[model samples]
Target: MFEQIDCPEAQRLVEAGAQLVDVRGPDEFARGALPGAQNIPVQVMAQQAGQLEEHKPVVLYCASGARSTQAQMLLQQLGFPEVYNLGSIQKYYTC
Candidate 1:
């Protein structure tokens, strides 16, 4: 199962080199996103999954927790070793 972490832990993970993926749409992403996060909408995550480096861990978040949870499952099914759901971007930004 994928682990769900809070904003503080997410920050630590990113600092430790975990890949931060914002699973929001282009418009949402264009507005703003966590610093260092790459935009990868959940709809296209499967196809773009390969672009992620296998050697590093991956953390996903969206507007709400739902999409990122789905993404976490998809990446896990694709054999990603460490997949974390950081829930909503609001949680991270407000922290």
Candidate 2:
């Protein structure tokens, strides 16, 4: 299973320049997203994985925890060294 990072840790990662990604669909991301999040919906994440910085930590979230979990796993398989699932977008507000 992928690791579910806490809000504070997510915030710390963001503060330290982690790539913040929203793994929901484009429409859902258009509705709203955590501040500073970049939309890279899980559907096309593999194709766009190259857009993410390999040297930076990645933090991903979705409406629920599911999509982000998938994203985290993909990034890991793609050789991203520090990928984290921040779970739901709601968790960002808590941080």
Q: Where is the poorest 10-residue window by lDDT in model 1?
A: 1-10
Residue 66 displacement in candidate 1 (angstroms)? 0.5
Off by over 4 Å in 2: none
Clashes of each: 0, 0
Candidate 1 lDDT over 2-90, as tens digits, reads 55799888999999999999999999999999999999999999999988997699999999899999999999899898899999999
What's the TM-score of every candidate structure?
0.94, 0.95
Query: For model 2, what is the alpha-carbon lDDT of residue 46?
Result: 99
lDDT for position 48 in model 1: 96
Any residue pairs clashing in model 1, and if so which?
none
